[model samples]
Target: MDRRTLLTSSLAGMAAAAASAPETRAQAGGSGPPPFAETMAEMTWQEADAAAKSGASVLWAFGVIEQHGPHLPLGTDVYIPSAVLRRARQILAERGHQAVILPAFYWGINQVSGAFPGSVEVQPATMIALMADVLSSVKKQGFARVFCTSGHGDALHNKTIFDGVTAGRAASGIDAAVLFNAPLVKRLGLDTASPAVLGFEVAESPARFIDVHAGDPETSAMLHIHPELVRKDLLPTLKSTDYGPADLAEWRKGQEAARAKTPLGYFGDPASADASRGAARLEGQAKAMAEVILARVGGK
Candidate 1:
């Protein structure tokens, strides 16, 4: 079977397993209003305190304010993760657990898009330090469990998150895990069984490595969540650039040449993107995330 078909089967199996999964402890707060009631940014300090006292877990959504393509906005990364987290939060609420989503982290390591307009870049070290601080602070606030997620799958971006989580766990002495797009991809059974399997292998798939950036998956997601921001006029002509799979030699080729390889900052056939498919994918992943959240907070 092809990789995509394999992934669909794996995710279906995971979902079926989740259906019979045991109930997890409510570490955030007791049953409250639904997850749709409010976001962390919208919660009052008093309400937050009460939830903490009740053992509410916090969900930190990661998104970068980087260029998507000529057709999509700079906030595509942010919008997609926030929407998926929101869906997971709703599911957690149904299970009598309280979860709150923090505002998106707009500043991320946007090395690839640094040359592109609208990219708010941060040093890798700085992003890691910042994530550590934020997560450590969350633990100090008495939330025993905290979940982190990112839709963007750049190698450096994933490195920052993993590093930050390691640092945060050490500093706070709490349980933490980053639901990186790669592990999600692997868990869903995409790609071969190489120990070095990278997220972009599947994420970029059958296109330029840059396909992970503004490809069909991302475009469809943006269409599902924020069609208003998508420039329909530009979609018709957008196509993957000439950049192919890279080698160690390409790593030495430097950033300028890298951008030159895919000048438009996009790399896949977005023409295939569909909102319904995007919605289904998002829902499945969100369910997987909710299952992980429940297991982490208090499952055997």
Candidate 2:
């Protein structure tokens, strides 16, 4: 069977099995938000206002609708960040700190992925404006700590959003503090020497030695967190390309050469992906993110 068909069939079966399984408050033996049923709706204004009033820290997961390889969902970018935020919320709840997770931002700057079908690219200026407006609204509601998490591959775009939030705070004199997920990811060590590290590449250094895009780490992550979304069986086998010696100079040169050389718009080995790897990466990211939020929220 084709990858898509195989993925669909497998996911359908998994969902059915999940439905038949008994529901529980905790599955991973970790603590955080009380349960999915207990947390408020992540996206609504009313929810944000209520959460702030209840003394909860506000966290937003920024995502984009972009192409992953032929085997992954277009919303993979969105799901990864959202999953991290959800996991963070759970961790914070365990520490007695209430956290309100904002909804995922599916529209983002996706120039590289724009050539692919189903990818939507928002202009950089447009994304900055939208994020500023959202944060402004949240600050006005008295959310003291605002966390911005992104899973998209564009480091520059993510930095723009972070700078925009900083500018918004300065211009409006809002007391809110914004934290981006990229630095947090690095601090957490989830992308350590893995193919997914390329996800951190920017236009300045488009080609990194690691395959950060739709490669092993990313695909593995999807397989673990949202297995239904990955079509592993139907994916094309890719001949792995190394950007020569791994260094900053070579990395930049490789990225420049890659833009002209690779047409698929992805790097890394997807065949090596596994659900267990994704779960480990996700847990690491969540733990590190939770610590940051707690520190920001003044938790001990």
lDDT by residue (73-131, candidate 2, tens digit) is: 77777777777778878899999998887666678776555556677877877877777
TM-score of 2: 0.70
- Relative to the true structure, how large is the alpha-carbon lDDT of every model? 0.70, 0.64
Candidate 2 residue 184 C-alpha distance from true site, Å: 8.4
- Please estimate how well model 2 matches the true structure, expressed as its whole-model Cα lDDT: 0.64
* Residue-pair clashes per candidate: 6, 7
Stretches of candidate 1 above 4 Å error? 1-37, 182-210, 240-254
TM-score of every candidate relative to the true structure = 0.75, 0.70
lDDT of model 1, residue 221: 85
After superposition, candidate 2 runs with Cα above 4 Å error: 1-48, 175-178, 181-209, 244-260
